[model samples]
Target: MTPYKSKKSFKTRLVIAISIVNLAVILAITYLTYRWNAQQLQEQTIAQTQQTIEQAGTNVSTYMDELYRLTLTPYYNDEVLSQLEYSPTNSRDKLNSKRVVEGFLSSVMTLPRSEILRVYIANDDSLYSYTRTPNDMPDLATYAESSWYNEAKETTKPLFIEPHMERVYGEKPTTVFSVVRQLRSKNDNSKTIGVVKVDADYSGISKICNKINLNAGGLLLIVNSQNQVLYRSAPIPSGLEDAMADGNKIGQSGTITLNGQKYLVNVLSLSNYSINIVALHSYRTLMAPLRSNLMKSIALAIFCIMLADIGFYIIIQKFTQQLFEIVALMHHVEDGDLTVKAHVTTNDEIGYLAESFNQMTEALQNVIDRNAQLAKEIYQAQYLAKEAQYNSLCSQIRPHFLYNTLNTISLLIKCEEYDTAIRAIESFSAFLGGVMNVSKDISLQKELDICQAYLKLVQLRYQDRLQYDISVSAELYSEQIPSLTIQPLIENAIKYACEQNRGQTVIHIVSCVSQDRYSIQVSDNGPGIKPETLESLQQRISTPSHDETEPAHVGNIGLVNIAKRLRLKYGNSASLDILSSDSGTTVSISLPFTKNEVTQ
Candidate 1:
C-alpha cells in the first residue's frame, strides 16, 4: 500500500513541483535585489529633489521678504501719512496737498529696476490721490468690490495680490501683482487712514521662476495664500493642474497624474508662511535608472534559465495536455457557453478529474438558470404589487368621492339649482370612468376636468366657503400625469380644510414648463397644518421603505404613495414639494419634460 501511494504521488505533480522550485528561486532573488536597489535610488532622488526645492524656496522667501519690507517703509513715511489724512478746506489747500502726495508717488513710480509700476492710494479724500496718471486704472467703484482691496482694508499686515490682467500703466492690459498695506494716521499711528497699493514687477517674478532647474515637461509655481497662481514657469494640462491649483494645504510631497503620465509634486511654504513655492517633476525621469536596471536583470534571468533547462518538452506535453483541455473548457464557461462537455475516453485519474469538473459546471449552470428565473419573478411581482396598489387606491377613491359628490348633487337639486345638478352628475360620471383607466397615463386636461368636477361638488357642499382656480395652459392639457394625481391634492385640501371648518378655503392649481422641466403646483390658503404633522408627512414621503406591500392605510390621499409612484416611474428626476405656512400650503410636482413628450 505504501509503495502504491508513493507511485501515485510521484506521477501526480512531479513536473509541477520541479518547475515551481526552479522558477521561484530565480524570481525571488531577482525581485529582492531589484527592490532594494530601486528603493535606495528612490530615496536618494527624493533627498536631492527635496534639497533643490528647499533652496528654491529659500531664494524666493528672501525676494518676497524684500517686497514685504518695502511695505514697512511706507508705514513710517509720516510725510505721506500726513498728506493721506489731510482734508483740504479750499482748492488752494487741495492743490498744495496734491503736489506733496504727487512728489511722494513720482519718486516711487520712477524707482530704478523697480517692479513697483504704480504706487497709489484707493481713497476718495480730496487731499489723497487715487492714481498717479499713467492714465488708465480700474474705476474707483470697482476697487471697493475687489477682494484684495477688502483684504488689505481689513488687515494691518502686507497682502500679496495674485497676478491678474489689470491696466496698471495704461489702457493696455498687463499682468500685475501687487502689495497692499493699510496706511496709518500720522497724528495717531494706531488708526488706519487708507489702503496703499503698489504693483510689483512681473518681469522680476518671471526671472526668479525661470532660473529654477526642471526636466522637460516639468513645472514650477509661486502661489499666494489662496493658491491662485502668482507666477507659473510652465503651462500644465488641466487634469494635473486642477487639483494642485486647488490644494491650499498639503505636506511636503505627493503624486499626481495627467494624460497617463505621473508627476511628483513638492510643496514648500515660504518663510513668511503665506506664499507657496511648488515644484513638479516628471515621474518617468525620476524612474529612468530603475527601468534600465530592470532590463539588464531580465536579460541575465534569460541566460540563467537557458543554462538551467533540462529539456523535458515531451514529458511536459503529456502532463500539460489534460490541463490545457481543462483551461479551454473554463474559457468556454467564462464566455457563457455552458453546453460544451469534456469527452473523458480514459478511465484513469485524468478522466475522473474531467468528469468531476463537468458535473460541477452543469450544477453551476443550473443554479444560474434558477437565479435568472427568480429575478424575473421578483420583477413581475413588483409591477403587479404596484398595479394592485394603483387599483386599490382608485377603488378607495370612488366611494369617498361619489358619496360626497352625490350628497352635493342632492343638495343642489333640493336648492332648486336643477341645471347645475345635472352638469355635476355628467362631470362626475366622466371623471369616475377615467379613474378606472388605471393602466395608461391620463392627460393633465382630463385631470383638470376631474378637479373642476370635484370642486363644483365641494362648492355646492360649502356654497360660500370654497373658491378654487386652475391656471393650467390648454397647450399643457395634452401632457401626461398619473391618474388621479391632481384630484388627490384637491381632495386632500378639501378634506382637511372642511374638517377644520375654516370659513374660507382658496385652492389654486398652477402648472408651467420651463426648459426641460415640467411642474404642477397645488396651492391652498386654508388653515395651515401643525408644524410637526407637516414635517412627519414630508419625511414619510421622501424616505420610502423597501417594502412594496400595501399598508393598512393605503386608502385615501396617500401623499407618500403619490411620491412613490412618481419616483418609481421617473427615477429621481421627478419631485413632490410641499411648502406650508400660517397663511397657505403649496404642493409642487416637477418632472422632466419636452413638448413631444405629450402623447395623443
Candidate 2:
C-alpha cells in the first residue's frame, strides 16, 4: 500500500515538472521572437524616414543650383563687362555707352524670373549700372570694404549672401538673399572692373523649405556651411543648434527632447549646396503605425499559444491516463492478481509494456496452477530425505567403533593401563555427546574433536599398523561445517587403507583456508582405488545421486550422503571433493568461508 501511494505521487510530480519546463521554454521563445521583430521594425522605420529626408534635400539642392546658374549668366556677358572699363571722353559717347549698357541690362532683366528683386553692376568710377530699384546702388569704395565685397574678392565662384534686409532705404525693408560675383576685365583676368550682385526675394526661399516636413511636429531647417540657420519651417531647438555649431557628426534618428516631447533628430548633407538639413521627427508619431502592427502580431501569437497550450494539456492528460491504467494493473499484480490483464490503449512503449505485463501475468498463473498439483508429492519426498539425513548425522560413528573401543579398554584395564583407558573413555564420551545433538552443523573445532576421537579409538584397535596425523590452523577454529562431516572421510580412509592393505596405513587430516573457503581434508598413504571405481565414486560424491531401488547401509553413512547434507546446508557454495591415484586417496570438505559466524 505504501509503495503504491509513493509511485502515484512520483508520477504526478514528474508530469507537473515536464509541463512546467515546456511552458518556460515556450515563453522564452516567444519573448525572443517579439524582441527581434520589434528591433527589425524599428530599424526599417528609421531607414525609410531618412530616405524621404534625403529626397527633400535633393530638391532643395536643385533650387540652389538654379540660383547659382542665374547669377553666373550676367558675369559671362562680354557686353555688360566691357562697359565697366569704358571711360567716356565726351557727352555723346557717354550717352552712347549708357544706351548700350541699358539695352543689355534690359534683356537680362526680361529673362524668366519674377522673384529676382534686382541685378546691379558697379565699379569705383561709376562707369555703368543697372538696377530694378532706382538709387539702390551703394557707394563703391565704402561697399568694397564691407563683408560681402571682402568675401566675394576672395573667390571667383558665385557666393550666396545670408538673408538680410536691404539697408539702402532708411526704414526697414524687404528681406533678401543675394548672390555676389566680382566682374573681371575681358582681356586681363586680374583687372578690377566691377561687381554684379543679384538679390532673390524672400518668398522664393520660403517656397523651397515650407512644403517639406518629416512628420507632425517635426522641425525642418537648412543651415549654411557656417551652421547658421538660413531658412526653416520652425526655429531650431537650442540643443540641436548647439550640436550643429560644435561640428559633431551626430548619427541619424536618435532621441532628443524638444519642448518636453521626445523627437528623433536626423541630418542630411546636401552635396550640390553649402548647407545641411536638420529634421526633427516626433518619436511617438513616427512609431504609431509600427506599434499598431506589433500589437496585432502579439495578440495573434498569444491566441495561437493559448490554443496550443490547450491541446498540450489534453495530450498530457491522455498520456497520464494511459500510465494510470498501467499503474492500476501493477497494483493488482502486487496484490497477487496473477490473473489480471492490463488494457492496452495506444501502440506506444507504454502499451507494449502493458501487453508484455499481461502475458507475464497469464504465464505466472499457469505456472502456479501446475506447481500446486505437484506440491504434496514433493513435500513427502523431501520429508523422507530429511529424515534419512537426520538419522545419518546421528549415527556417523559405526557401532563397530564403540565395540572396538570398549574391547581396547578391556585390554588396557587388564594390562593395568588406567590412564590410557580413562582417556579413551572420555574421548568416546565427548564424541558420542556431539553426535547426539540434533544440530546438523557444528564449528570446525568441534567437528575436528569428533574426528580426533574416532581416530583415537581406531588407533587403539590397530596400535602399530594405524598411523595418523591432524593439522589445522588456529584461525579456522570457528568456521562451521556439517556435524561429523570429516569423521566419515577419516573412517573411510581407515577402512580402505588399514583394513584392506598389508602394508602400514598412514592417515593425514588437515584443515586450511583457501580461496574464501574453509577446507578440511582426509588423506591416506595406501594403495589407491582402481581407476573405474574412482571415477564412478567421484560422480556420486560430486552430487548426491541415488537410485530408488538401492537400499541404505545398515551400520554407517557414506561420502555421497555427506555431500547431500552439504548441498542442503549451503547450496552450491559447499562441496565434497574426492581424488584418487596409485599413491593415495584424498577426500576434501569445502564450505563457504567468512570471518562472520554462519548459522545452520
Candidate 3:
C-alpha cells in the first residue's frame, strides 16, 4: 500500500509540471497570433492611405498640365501674337484697330475654358488697342520703361505678371496675370514692332482653387514660385505664404498644422510655372481606425489573461484524470471551441491541468472576437465602395448638360438668325469646350474671354436689362490661371445681379496684378443682396430659402454653382468674398501669381 501511494505522488508531480508547460505554450501561441494579425492590419491600412494620397496628387498634376495646353499655347504661338500687335497710325486707324482687337478678343474668349480676361496691344509708347474702352488711352510711353516691358524686351519670352489691384477699374478690385509677347515686323525679322499683351482674370484661378475636392478639414493651397499665397480660403492664418515658400518641391510629403488640425501634406510642383500645389489630409482622422483597433487588441489580451486564471483552478482533482481532461480541452480550443472546459477532480496534478485548460479557452475567445471585427471591416469597405461610385456618377452631370447646350446652339444656327446665331454658336462652343478641358491650367486672358462669351450670351438673353463693363491692364494678361474659372462668376452676375431688375443693371468686371498675387472683382449696380445671402455666398453654405412662389432671383443656380466650383478648384487658394449693403453687391476673387507655361 505504501509503494502504491509513493508511485501515485510521483505521477502527480509529473502531470503538474506538464500542465504548467502546456499553459506557457498556449500563451505563446496567442501572443504570436495577435501580433501577426495586428501587423497585417497596420500594413494594409498604411498602404491604402498612401495609395489614396498618391492618386490625388497624380490627378491634380494631370489637371494642371491640361490647363496649360488649352490656355497658354495660343498666346505663345506667333500667328496669334502677330495679329495682336499694336499698329494704328491715326485716330480712325486706332478705332479700326480697336475693332480688330475686339474681334480677336472675342475669338480668344470663345475658346472652351479659356481664362483670358482681355487682349491689348501696345505700340512704341502708346496703348493702341484693348478690350477695355480706353479713357484717353493711357500713355504707354511710361509703361515701356516698366519692368514688365523691359522683361519682355530682354527675353522676348512671354512674361507672367504678379498680382495687383487695378486703379482704373474703381474701388472694386480684381487680380490680373499678364502675358506679353514681342511682335516682330513681318518685313524685317529683327525689327520689333510692338508687344501683344493678354490679361487673364485671376478670379478664374480662384474659382478653380476653390473647387478642389478635399477631405474634411483638408486644405489645398496654391503658392507661386516667389512663395506668395495667391489665394486662400477664408480666415487665412498669417505666415502661410512663408510656409509654402519654404516647402515648395514636387512630390514632397510632410506634416503641417492648420487651424489646430494636423495634416499630412503633399506638394506637386507645376511643370511650367513656379507654382506649387499643396494638398492636405487630416492625419488624426486617417489614423483613427488604427487607434481603435489597437485598443480592442489590448482589451482582448486582458480578457484572455483573466479567463485563464479563474478557469484553471476550478477544474482539477486527480493527476491522471486531470491530464487527459486538460489535453482534451486544448484540442477543443484549437478546433475553435471556447465552450469546452477541463473536468479534473484532484488538488494535485488535476488542479494544474484545469489552469492550462482555462488559458486555452481564453485564447480561443480572442480569436473569435478578432474574426467578428474583421467581418465588420469588410462590410464597411463595401459601403464605402458604393458611396464612391455614387459620387463619380454625380460628377458626370455637368458634362452632359454642356453637350445638350452645344446641340441647342447648333440647332439655332441652322434656323438662320445669322448674327445672333453666330454669337450664340460661338458662346455655346466656348462653354462646352471649356468644360471638356476642365483639367487644364489656363492663362488669365483666356479665362476672361470665356467670361466675356458667357456674359454675351447672358446679355443677349436679358437684352435691355443687363449691361457689363470690364477693365484690365495690358500689363497683367499672361499669368497662368485654372481653366473655366471666370464664366461661372459672369453667369452668377447675370443671374443674381440683373434677373430681378426691370431697370438697366450694370455689372463691372475688373482685374489687376500686384507683387505676388492677383485679384478679380465682379460687382453689380442693382439691389444689393441681403446680409444673410452675402454671408452664405462667402462661406459657400447653401440653404434653400426659396419656395416655388418665390421669384427666380431669390435663389440663383449660377451663383451656387460658381461657389461650389470655386471651392473645388482652388481648395484654399481661392476665395469668394461677397460684400453687400446700400451699395451694390461685389464678389472679389484673389489668387497667386504663377508663371506657368503651357506645354505643346
Candidate 4:
C-alpha cells in the first residue's frame, strides 16, 4: 500500500511537470512567432512605402520635364528670340515687342494645362506677362532682384526654385513653384538678352501624390531643394521636416516619432528636378495586422496547451494503470511472494514490461530452488569470461606483429641485404613460435625471450633508430604471468616511439619486487602521449568489459585488452598504470607474488 501511494504521487507529479513544460513551450513559441511575423510585416511595409515614393518621384519628374520644355518655347520661335534680343530705342518699338512676346507666351499657356498659372519674360528695362488668371506681375526691376531671376541669370539650365508667396498677385497671395531659364542672343550665344519664367501651382504635384494610396494616417510630401514643402497630401507632422532634411543629406530610409506617433519615413529624389518625395506611414497602422495575428497566436497557444494537458492526462492514466499492477506485484515479491505475476494484456511496451515482470518472478523462484547449482554455474561463467578475455587479447597481439615483421623482412630483401633479411626471418620465426604457446600463463623469462626476438626484428627494420634493454632478476625469471601481457606493452612503447620521431628512441624494461608484489616497468623516451590521449587510455583500460560477445577489439584497443586480461587473471590484486610527461612515458604492471599464479 505504501509503494502504491508513492507511485500514485510520482505519477501525479510527473503529469503536472509535463503539463507545465508544455504550457511554457507553447507560450514561448507563440511569442517568438508573433515577434517574427511583426518584424516581417514591418520590413514589408517599409519596402512598399519606399517603392511608392519612387513611383511618385518618377511621376513628378515627368511633370517637371514637361514644365521645363514649356520654358524652351522662346528658343523654338524666331520672332520670340528677336523680341527677347530687341533693345528698342522708343516706347512704340518696345510696345510692339511686348505685344508680340506676350502673345507668344499667351499661346503657350492655352494648352489645356491648369497647373501653369502664369509665364513672364523680363529684362533689366521691361517685363512682359501672360497668365490664365488675370494677376499682377512683378516689374523688371523687382523680378531681377528675386532669387529665381538671379539663379536663372547665372546658369543656362532651367532652375526649379522653391515655393514662395506671390504677394504681388491680385485678390490673395498664391503659393507657386517656378522654373526659370536665361535667354541668350541667338546671334551671340554667350550674350544674355532676358530670362523666361514659368510658374506652377501645386496641382500637378498633388495629382502625382494622390495616385499613391498610403492607407490611413499616411502622409506624402514634395519638398524642394531647400527642404521647403511644395505639396502635402495631408496635415504636416511636427519634426518631419527636420527628418526629411537629414534623410535627404544621408539618402537613407528610417523611422521617426512625430507628435508621439511612430512613422516610417522614406525619401525618393526626383532626378529631373531638385526635389524629393517624402512618404510617411504610421507604424501603428502598418502593424495593425501583426497585433491581430499576435492575438490569434496567443489564443491558439492556449487552445493547444489545454488540449495537450487533457491528452497527457489520458495517456498518463492509461500508462500508469499497467504500471500500478506491476508495482503491486513488486510489493508482493518484496515480501517473498515469488508466485505473484503481472498479467500481460497488450502487445505494447507495457505488455512487454508485464511479461518481463512475470519472467523475473519465475526466475527468482528458480534461483531459490537451486542455490548450490547457481553458485557453481556462476563460478564457471567467471572462469570462461577470463579465458575469453585472454584469448581475445592474444589474437589481437599475434596478427599485427607478424605483418610488421614480414613487411620489414620484405623491405630488407628488396634492398638486397640478404643476410640481414635472413636473420630477421629467423627472429620472426622464433617470435612466432614463442607467441603460439597459447597457455594462459607464461614464465617471465620466456616472455622476455619473445620480446627480445621481437625487438631484434624491430631493430633490423629501424636500424640505428631503435634500441632496447631488458633487466630482470634471475630469481624472478620463472615468475608466471598472463601470456602476451608484457610483450604487447613493450610493442606499444616501441611502436609509439619510432612512429613519432626520427631521433633514437630507447625502450627499457625492468622488473622490481617489493614485499609481495612483483612489478614490471616499461619506459620509452619517445614523444610522450598528449594528456588528453593518456587520460582516455587510462579510462578505457580501467573499465572492465562485462560482455564476452563484444566484437574483436581494433586500433590501440590492444592496450585496453591487456589491462583487462591482467585484471581478470589476478582480480583486484593486479593493476596496470601509465605515467607520462613531455619527456617520456612509462607503463607499469603490478601483480601479487604469491607463487606468481592467478586465482582459480
* 283-360: candidate 2 lDDT, tens digit per residue: 666666656656666656554545554554566667766666777788889998887778898898978988888889
The true-structure Cα RMSD of candidate 1 reads: 20.3
What is the C-alpha lDDT profile of model 1 across 1-600, one tens digit per residue?
A: 354455345544554444556666867777788788867866665566677768887776677677767666655667766767767789897787777776766554336445666666755453234343343346455776777667887888888765666665435566776677877776787776777776665677677778877654467777666556667877755765676566834446777677888777778877454567777777777667667777677656654554345355457646656755776788898998887788776678878888988998899989999999999999999888877765664555456656666777788889898887887777677767666655447777777877886787677567778888889755576677677777778877877765475577888988888888889998888777789989878877777667633452543345666776676667789988889887877889898774542222
In candidate 4, list every pair of residues with a backbone clash.
none
Clash pairs detected, candidate 2 = none
Taken over the whole model, the C-alpha lDDT of each candidate is 0.69, 0.68, 0.58, 0.77
Location of the lowest summed lDDT over 10 successive residues in candidate 3: 544-553
TM-score of each: 0.40, 0.37, 0.37, 0.41
lDDT of 4 by residue, 300-344 (tens): 765565556556467666766787889877888999899987878
Candidate 4 overall Cα lDDT vs. reference? 0.77
Output the lDDT of residue 335, model 4: 95
lDDT minimum window of 10 residues, candidate 4 = 591-600
**What is the Å distance of residue 521 in model 1 from its true position?**
1.0
Query: Which candidate wins on TM-score?
Result: 4
For model 1, which pairs clash?
115-201
User: If both were scored by TM-score, which would come out higher, candidate 1 or candidate 2?
Assistant: 1
